[model samples]
Target: MIKSPTAHEISYGLVELNPDGTIQRANDEAKRVLISEDGDSNYLFHRITNNEIKTKLHECFMGRANEFIVTIDNQPVFFLFHRSNNEQSQDRIHVYLFNIYNLLTLHDHNNWNNHLLSSIGEMAAGIAHEVRNPLTAVKGFLQLMEQTYKEEYSHIAQSELDRAIHILNDLMSVSKPEFVQEEKAAFNVCSKIESILLLFQNQLYDINVIKSFQDETAMVVGRRDQIKKALFNLIKNAIEAMSDGGTLMIEQYEDGHDVHINISDSGVGIPKDKLRLLGTPFFTLKQDGKGMGLAQVFNAIQSNHGKIRVTSEEGIGTTFYLSFPKKSQYSTQFIGGNTMLQVVDSKTDLTDFLFKNLDFYTREWVQYLEKNKSYITSLLKENGEMEQYDRAGNPIMKLVAQNILEIKTELIMDVAKERGVKSAKTEFPMHLAWELFQSSRGIIWNAIKSFYQESQNTLSTEEFFTLERNVNDIIDLYIDSYTAYYVNYKEDLLKSHRETVDELSVPIIPIAERVCILPIVGNVDTYRAKKIREKTLVRVKELKANQLIIDISGVPFVDTAVVNHLFKIVKGIKLLGCSTILTGISAEIADTMIELGIEIDNELKTRSDLQQALQDIQQFRIGKD
Candidate 1:
């Protein structure tokens, strides 16, 4: 029986590479690896599932690495590159194809299956014990109600009991070893979805559910209950999101190859950092949330060979795109009695070919930038980084070229995972980053198209789509990375500016030689009052002022803390060898100051207004003269 279809379990191909990273010779297995299994036709070599192997192999040859290990599609594969010893060959490397899981015996696979079953049994037994107590309590309550002839009380009790049962059932459903796939049944998903929506109609009372159907009924091949369970998890999630009452949208549509159902909720959206971790077991954003709901959702979909994609903006909302490949008689994988999902591993080799001509592609990228100078110019305008853009022979253009030349598909994805705010703020902001990527993508694709045209004659439709997707992946990777970083950078920039403004909110202004005014113009909270004290003392020392006047006429109220701060400022100024003057002591401020037991120092002068203080300073200076 076929167990896990890991990458190691799949066939391997050996392709010899010269020192310069050019393909020297490919054996039969390599051709098979490149081609689709159905026709043995040449598939795109760059489209291989673990194509990172090729990049690592190339890196080893380039002397960048001696060994590379990577896990692709859940299978870990590694490569060891060795230098060939020969008088004739100056630089040659031999790479052996080794299967990581080849060490596993048949007995080990059986042991895994046994261990999984035992774990399930243990969990089920625990659940049984918990439910038994509740079940016994309900039985006793029913007997009491029956003896009392209390029909209304019985009904209320029964209703609550039913709710408990429902919740328990939901728990049990998620805890089961399997997410419950219907082994036999073909049903239209349209009806199932409508039924589930109607069930939630009352629950979504304040929430608007907008439903759009491009394909009214989808012919899904699988268990209807299983599909419904997944749909229930998603819709329940949607309902939970709208606590504040927002729109919940469900869109069902079909493209040529797959059916898509998008469920979107206008609620507190997830951040990108948290979005990456959505479907993991016991992970949820909700308060005291268990991941059972989404776990079941993911399990059901995976059981039926479906794919899920999620996109969310922090404030806007979240939308989930669930795709089920059009169930066909032609495409199905069978392991034992279970039907497994077989994704069409359509890929393109043109990427490897393109990687070889990095300089050529870089020039193409530059030509692209030159063509779309107007757009690039618009993006650059008004960005502060523009001053940072004086070209060292057009640094932006050259950097775009370098990104293309050095990009392996894996690097594109790795960049996406890391390009969040910290990197984005330090490197490039979103608008500029996206503009650069979009411009470069056009050029990158143009270069890829040129390479494809060279071999387009023998390529199949699958091969062409593979090429299109791989090229699309390059742009997609850049844009995904660019957008994530952009969002974070914008957020960080806003937060930073807010902090800067808050820091500089309290201003000490110098109006005369060695004399300055510290204005307290707004509502003086404890925070602002503290800032005032800090800034005033620093200003007095910095200016070497003989007099420091604090004006509080614009202040609404002098609270107890504000009074304390004023007295402290007076004391601090005296220590700095400067006389302190209080101006704008309003009747209300004076009363509060008196109540707070604040007394001015004997040397400190109190002025009703700023004009009086300035006049006194002028007279005192004249008298000294």
Candidate 2:
């Protein structure tokens, strides 16, 4: 039979750069990897990004470092380079690229889904199996409502609730991985094998029953009855295979914390094709076979935390090995509730277990978000748009995933700090920080809640408490750390805002050709007076202004010292061939100026208001003609 292909080819791109760091050659995939639109390879990276990628690529040549993941076109990709010495140029770089988007998409589409539409169609066909009872109940309720109200329109409310039932039916079609709660307890494998031996003792009269007990270390963490039934099936098959007479060998031993039971039989062995399908449902090689024996045997072992492997050659013999973790209830060091966590952690594949189930965690979080979708959306939307918070593929989710892969708390804090600065600079406010923190907490809690829901009922009292406390502590730690980073960044942002506002107060407005106005607003204290003098001179020189208007209409307070500083500013402007045009002189300011020996006319020109000064400058041909 021809089998459909269920695998995908991983995509890769390569580029060879000259010793001097210029692109020499690139393949079609390389152009795609670089997000090049024109398909040109020459000076590509330079044209695309700053020298950041070039620098990082060059660093790959240093020492033995050859590969690392880098973000190219806003997605992570494996950046690898081979440093080979070039005869014509410097060190030649052979670049290789493989991005995360393609890898993850393949895992999602090709590996995860095979004929999804077909499966959905099949599920739709069986939809009646699930919705039958619900529909019956709803129909009965709707009839009751109609009778009670004595009107057909009265049951419209009950009828409308059919959408929820439809949704429930839809959920059943999507297969979530079956997570069976494992109840761990010490059970003797040798005892189970012995029981099977006793059960088959009378039946295996023609066969020679040879049993080997190797040190009797047969304790494993599983239900004993399941093991007994599975072992009995294996032993019975062995006995049945040998109709005339044959040796049925049974051996049990423990290797470290793993218990192994090996069963062998010299009988009419199974064929290669049938051997592979031995445990498949309704599959059998025997003439008088129900086909549920091996399937039940496989399920019994699998359900009780055990793995079974079968090896056989036709007309020779068949051997089976059942392996399971040796019980460690009394052996392990007992702590508080953490005992359960320790057991799970020990049994856990620390490498892939967490990652393999990350989708489950994310899905749970998304479901939670949807549950409160209305409230969250209302809180986030501002001016008809969500305030930095997106319902799909949001930054918080992306960051959480990255953190799941690597402990990027410090990196995250740094980014938060930078965000604070940008937020402060952009006036994005501190509430956004809190928003991300709160939403992330919601996701984390949802994940923990789901995990607890799945296993809490099956865990020991000690393990359950330990798991809850650990989850709480982790959440508290995140809250404390994230708050610290956000607060620090927010403070920095506030400080930057203050400095910016202060700088903006001293306004420099360019009016006409070679003329600028320095509108000094509010009270001119000693500090403001000093800044005014310095900034005025800098503006005049920078703008090449021949004239400057000192508007004091906005300043309510002017002391004798401030008057002297004005004269000094005029003198400084004279030195630069830029004349000072003073405006907004009141009667109070005129008396102070007279006391300082300053002439209002010509010596130090003054006007009642800014319009008068500009008109005077224009009349005298000093302003832009």
Candidate 3:
């Protein structure tokens, strides 16, 4: 009697062979993928040329090993061999074959990525020096001009030149760190990691975060900001990997000698062959990435006396295991706090606990603020503002709760600024606003204490402080943004009172038919520079000018930023079919431009003074006529 074929035989190219390597039976897939056109069963066994693979297959028949890979006709194939357990029939080998062509293609791509990254690192320093040399020489000339002239414009020019040089220095530092350096300090690894995680709160709505932070005082000696930036990139990558939403597991623990942080994600895992190319510069799996993120991460880890190991299986997930040599230090207590930010990674539990008691804390906060019955407070009370304040606490607490739950603070601060501006518009007393913000901190801390007691005091010292700092830091930021906006709005009102209506306008005077003169007389700041660009184009088009003469003779100074603004204005004017003739090139201004390495635009006509510019324009008109 004949038996039915298994699923493996139907799906894959399956073939059954006797112990002596003779063909028993072949599936349709097996004939198409493994067997030759002659339809001989011996061809399958004879195709595997590797002696090691042959030995492994022989062992599979003897009931020892069951999996082996072999190359047949320059193509890699996977074979799964199993011995049949049938009492009535003879012992046979059941082999499942699969083609792994795509995987090898990916391997080839990663190898190319690795080679390209090596070339970039070697060329970085050369590029930096080649760009910086001209700027350095120009800066030297500008210094001499500043000494000879003792002008304010040269000082402005020098400042802008320094900024350009600084950027080049930073580029060189990232590419070749020994060329530039930073100081390393001992910082709380757990708290830093927690803070970085908070930056990704909005993206975590669909993600389930599981944090297992055992050692809160896991100190790592490194450049604090650089390490933070590196961790931010790694976490950002982890979040991007899970587009469909999955588990994000962040664990931090310590052995006797070292502290370890394991960041794992249940996303599309990286293939084994491509893992080595992960930190290579300009290499990325994501569609919209510059690829410097992981490169910086790798550089930071190594520079900070840390090691990173990664393990991943395609379609399963990936984990980054980072170990740093532990820096042993006694915990110091922060003033007004339990212990100095020895924080744990119990983000989910702590956030949920605070949210559960959010209402109680909100009421306590409003009641405390209401005790201040001053004139502003009394006026607000009559306007039903107390209820509004009470109502506002819920959403604010939700934002703060999101912060504790590990979310970004940008939206929270934006809301804070809006509220601050509204308070200013209502003429609310700044001190009373301060008191309102100050009182909430105490109420939230009280709620945290209740959570601790209710949970039977099981919270670790580090875990308690982590929650404390997270709450305090967020409230402090809210207070800063709130107060800043309030004061800025009031100042803007005062500045408006002092200025005349005409002073707010950009001065554009029409000189001739299809020609205009914009004589700029005072210092041009970013705000005024933008206004200048807007009005100049409008006036030029209104007058139907073919030439716009911008005379900056009376203007005090032009920095690098002002130069950029002026260049943009010129470019815009050209796009509108009008020409710009710039006059008043002072010696100080000339030196500044040289130091900034600014090139004169070919379309722009420059002259020593307005008189010379008008002469050239008249001559050009005569020539055209």
Candidate 4:
């Protein structure tokens, strides 16, 4: 026969006291529940059983209330006592206990759900408030424009109307409470940031914003407009934080499977207490702030399955960090097989590619060094060589060494790039290389200390000194070699560029006596172009130059703003009594310039080659003489 289920077999000790409340026998369950294995059962029972409950039970036995129910640790139980009129008159009392763990669990679940719903509702309200004002302004402007422009200017009015409508559309998109469907697309992050900066050009100028971007490109998978909105919020907050004057840094990088965007400000940092509440819906530190900027940032990041962290010190500054998942090759080319094929085909084989481009030069250099190893060895052996090396290892040497370390850092970056990692450039800062070196040194020092402590033979004082000197010498040589190699490589690259520049004889002759060639390198945005123009003008006047050649060969891309600034430079140079020749119009640059609707052909002299510019300038000078 099956035994009764243990559910019922489970028992608690029952304590029944004399009418005077003397000692009573304790049941097994009560004993197990109230006392430890070695605890006194009588003492525990007396101490744990409620005095009021016992008194009330006695009263109930004497016919006060018929029954009573009470909770213990949120568990409900019933206590019943009966008194008989017979001669013995023994008191009969029973205790009934019930478990309510499941009930408590249900209650907690309901509460949590309610709290979550309330939070979502609050977020929705905050979003509506944040977006409605901008939308109202856009709508009002469009309506005014429509009314103001009757007939002839209707086309201009319509263009403005379309722009207003786009703004409203974007506002609606961001303000919606629902999660936006993910649209993973391959887009250049730097280009997107540049576009956003362009959108805020007026504000940037009014505030005298200073910005710098590393000359690198980052590609990521994201909703471009949404990310732009997030970045705008971050930057706008930063600008507001430094109302009088401050610096803002917007940087991106890739680490492992993550792409990070950092927006930092050199302004009054968030208070330590306020930092934790940065992304909360209604949290604000500024008097006039609505506090929705970071909330929206939170939503955007959450929508993208990303994370955000903020660190701030009271007097120092604040840094907001956002991390997005780095897109993989498979995700980047999810649309068509042809796209995947194109990506794969375009990728160069690492071994073959590195060898083909850099290996021959690297190998030749290595061989030359190997052949001259004795000379370097002799230098290394010279007395006080280590000290000399240490003394010469100044900032310039450090910078050069750092640059070499940066090149070697490509080993890490190449892995990320091959995997189609987003924000790879931003993630690998030069400091990380230095940190790695420090870590390696720590490991080496620890090993040496451990060996010294355990060594069977003790080192002589002279031997110890010699070993220390040798280690120092080794470190000095390594650093010096790295610095020398980096400097030499950079010099070689510049030398190559100079040779190429020398071959092209453009029309405008370099005023060797007065003018200096300030060839603008990298992508030229409007702000950079303006700065270049201003700086060149000042230099030209100071040098008392008669001619200037604004070389564009080093420029990788051109936009309308760039072309406009070039025109401004031409005007500025003319004001300084210097003729300007715009040289090195590559096919790509010409195409982009034309696309920008710029009339560079008439505004300034252009040459396909630098030689033509030099010739034209010489001829002009001779004629003038």
Candidate 5:
């Protein structure tokens, strides 16, 4: 049966209303639209709709504008209102409602699809271009090998193939970061960066490396290796850009809640027109670069809850600014060493004042600690442990100041206990640790007095006494918690060591004065390799060793990745002014390295056995003396 459509069933809505916006007659669609927006039918019999729509209705009644829009169900619905029979007795308003939501959505979807296809095509072209260059090199090397029957040609081909593989690996990492998962840990930013800078020791001969680390203990929590890789790429690019030898400045400072790291280079800068595409895949300025480096750098930083910004000029230079949320609980509001009266406004302001000038307090404390004639203090200074002492102690002091701002007793105690455990693990003396806290009381009071004096802000006697008591109470709580944890940790040290045997895999044993032996055994994975690098560097500094003996005789097999890690470790040691002697290269491992076309750095010394290596070191030291 064919049915004729009624007025209510038409495509568009129609309504007739009085001059005052009272609904005289309306179709079902018209009623539905009004109900959805107003949420009731009271507007149908009311004098006018709401104040939001009254202006439009008044304009329609006065023969002014006739069209307007109202959002219904999150879609814009157009309304056309016309005053009818203005010259006759029948004074009425005719309204037509139209919805174009589906049309707009279809338009947007088609546009987006076209853009996606275009982007896909561009990326595909870039991949092909990058992949073809290395393949072309490999092909040339293979042809040479075939004609000359030379092993050098084969090695070059293998190296070219490795390059291709590296490019593809980078692409996969940026596209799918989940392919490799890493654990997050809190590490000292200054220390890690210093280590990375050491990797470019050879390249630094022509360049000046300037480091301005304001907050040495600026800590961040992320995948340490990934962060290291990103930093390495940027620093490497900075070095490469300055081919004619320019200054490479790396600066780190902390603001209120974020840490800022700026790496600037004085080199041939990028074009301003191309600045917006700096991090896009396959967009680069270098001739031989794969163009994936910055892409990976951008992805790595963002994935680690960090932000990156870059600015460049054509002839001057470029700078990459990276910011990460600091893992501290204090506010660093003091900028440019300027103190204002606002810093002493109230009790909370006093706490902030202390934090803002924390560096001053730390410097004073370090000076006092260094002046002490105790054996522990002398060893700390001589072994370069003073910097670490400063880094570790700064946080606890900041926490104490934070506690004064707001009372969080449990959190303070837990952190103090953890610090205690750390001290015990590192074999730090409990007496000196306690003395560190005790000495801060006097330093802090002096700073507070100066703070008030410098700002000319006075506090009542009662207020000053109450502040002193609060500070002492929190310090005492921290000391108590730390002492308890320190004692308990010492008692269970052996059990804890047994549970964490993996951590003991990279044991740096002191073989003699100014020398240490690192005996690596078993399989070396990426995770363990990173731990080895960190531990080895730290132990070398602690022992004040001038040379390191890396005995890999016990390492059963050597893969390409392990070789790369070993090479990096040696380079890092070199940067620390320490020489590395690699021993126990078995025939099988040598064959694997050669087959993989690995090239050892010329400066790295090698010996057949540990005894021979020891003899070589003894002769060299004796001759120097």
Candidate 6:
């Protein structure tokens, strides 16, 4: 009687061999593993006896070897032969066969580890070479200070030395073979991280560190130093990644029974495969890297009963997420009606917390919308044909179509923003609203374009009247809503005044042949200051003016930087052999100049008003005559 093999036995390719080692019965997997479908079972063992493997199998059968590895039909197999009884007649040699596939897999893994270690070693050597110059400079400075000014400026020199030591420590940390030493302590996590960012004050010129803490006093009961080190490692990685520089965001919030922290970098991102093994020891793609930073991060997180997750792409950037269990509050108090009272505490909702504290999204969205509107207005003003459409298939409509197509870009900015704000409940609504607005605007623009095209050929009085009314109605609806919402919500949004028409002036004064004047009408900063410089240069060159007057009477304010930029422009004009007279220093501006101790070089003449400036330039011209 024969029993069928169980699923496990069949799956594992288990088979029992007869005393002589000829095949007694074979499972489906055993047959598949040992012999091809066309090969005969009687001839399978005989066929396997010709190669070097036959010699090994014979050794195993003769009890010369306890186990032998052989290949049958190019498939690797591990054979074990043993006798159940010592007596020759009753003795039966049992042979067990395994595919050795798992052993081969283990071998491959070992080889990969060896390769990874070799690469890491090479990277470590490079890092050492790269950091040595800075280290030497720091060491030399310290020694010189100790010999020259240690007694006089010991405190200051010691501080500089300490900073140098810290940098050296960071470099050594990367190269060190020691594992992370975890010292657990309860700490105000937000405050601790904020302090770390504050240390990078001088280096943050091109970097903006935006901190969003759901709880100002959020605490974590963990290894404070280890967490701080991990945060620094991630931020340092970010700064190095963004060669051009960008924002580093550190966000902290609490989910139900859990505290979450996210450190994101807007820098060169990691490859998907590399990102997967980012926390694996000695896995990095950086030119001079030991790959231990993220490995240490992983260890710190695990030891603290926390989890760390990383998401990255090749071009966009990378984000590190750290989460830990929230601690229970011992007591709660409500200061209401001039009395402090104990109350049943409910875990605060992060949505309500954020809504009450921060609405960066709403402000950012409003600014974005205003900028988009300004861009559209500029396009319309610059391209006259785009603002108007005519009948008879005008060629100008092609330019209009081209401009529209250019403006119709995918609204992916909100996608990136939403990804960063995924864990925030308060921003979710704002993100959705922005996405809807972008989508709706595209649809409406396309619909209006279609309607305009359809009505373009219909020059009949009735059709023309209908089309004109429809276009006006659509535009009015949009403009009215925009004006109403913007005027109500953001009345003082732009620096330019909206209501006082007289307060603003757009006077045109002839400077030279085919040249006119543009009196700057409002406050100017470094950005707008550059614009004035550019406009002046272009107009001066275009007009070939020998004498020009810049009237600044309408300007409300001017800083020293603005004044310096003006002086630079004057010098530039002088290099062109052109004379510049500044005309419009109001009493307030005059007072500001005096208060600020600003002195303008006498090369350029200035007057109390534009008329006086013009008069001065005219007098100079008359004197030249």
Query: Against the hidden reference, what TM-scores do the models get?
Result: 0.31, 0.30, 0.37, 0.30, 0.35, 0.31
Off by over 4 Å in 5: 1-122, 134-164, 329-625
For model 4, the stretches where C-alpha displacement exceeds 4 angstroms are 1-182, 202-215, 329-341, 344-625
Q: On lDDT, who's better, 4 or 6?
A: 6
lDDT of 3 by residue, 6-26 (tens): 423324568888767787778
Every candidate's lDDT = 0.62, 0.62, 0.70, 0.54, 0.73, 0.55
Instruction: Give the higher-TM-score candidate: 3 or 5.
Output: 3
Q: State the weakest 10-residue window (summed lDDT) of model 2.
A: 172-181
RMSD of 2: 36.4
Q: What lDDT, from 0 to 1, does candidate 6 have?
A: 0.55
Best by lDDT: 5
Worst 10 residues of 3 by lDDT: 329-338
Best by TM-score: 3
Instruction: Give per-candidate clash totals.
Output: 5, 1, 2, 27, 0, 0
Tell me the tens digit of each residue's lDDT in model 5 across 1-625.
Answer: 1122343332457888776666778877776655334444534434334455566656566645557776656667677876664312449878887664533334444554444445556667888888898899999988887687888888888888998898888787676556446755445566557656655755789999999989765667566678888999999999999999999999999888788999999999999766766676777788877678898899889877789999999879999999876754212211112232332346576777878878878877778776773566775665556777566545556776786655565576678777888777778888787677777777877877887888787765534544564566567667766776787778677657644865778789998888899999887777677778887888888888888999999888877777777878888888888989999999987887788787677668889989899899889889999
After superposition, the stretches of candidate 6 with alpha carbons farther than 4 Å from their true spots are 1-112, 115-119, 135-164, 171-221, 224-268, 272-299, 302-309, 316-545, 548-624
Quote the lDDT for 118 in model 3: 55
Poorest lDDT segment (10 consecutive residues) of candidate 5:
329-338
RMSD of candidate 1 to true structure, Å: 24.6
| Candidate 3: C-alpha lDDT | 0.70
The sequence of per-residue lDDT tens digits that candidate 4 reaches over residues 1-625 is 1111233233333555555444355565554443235635444334555665666665554544545655655555444443322212455344333233332334444554455445556656655665565556656666776678455455554565575555445444444434335454544455456445544544554354444444234545556566777888888777777766667778777767767778888788988755656676655777866665677788787655568888998767789888776655334233333343443332222223322324233333334434645454244335333343334322212222232212222332233233222212223223332433343344334433444565443444433442343333233333333333334344556677755654342223345776556566677777567666666776787778876777888878887677878878888888878776778888877776778776755447788767887787678668989
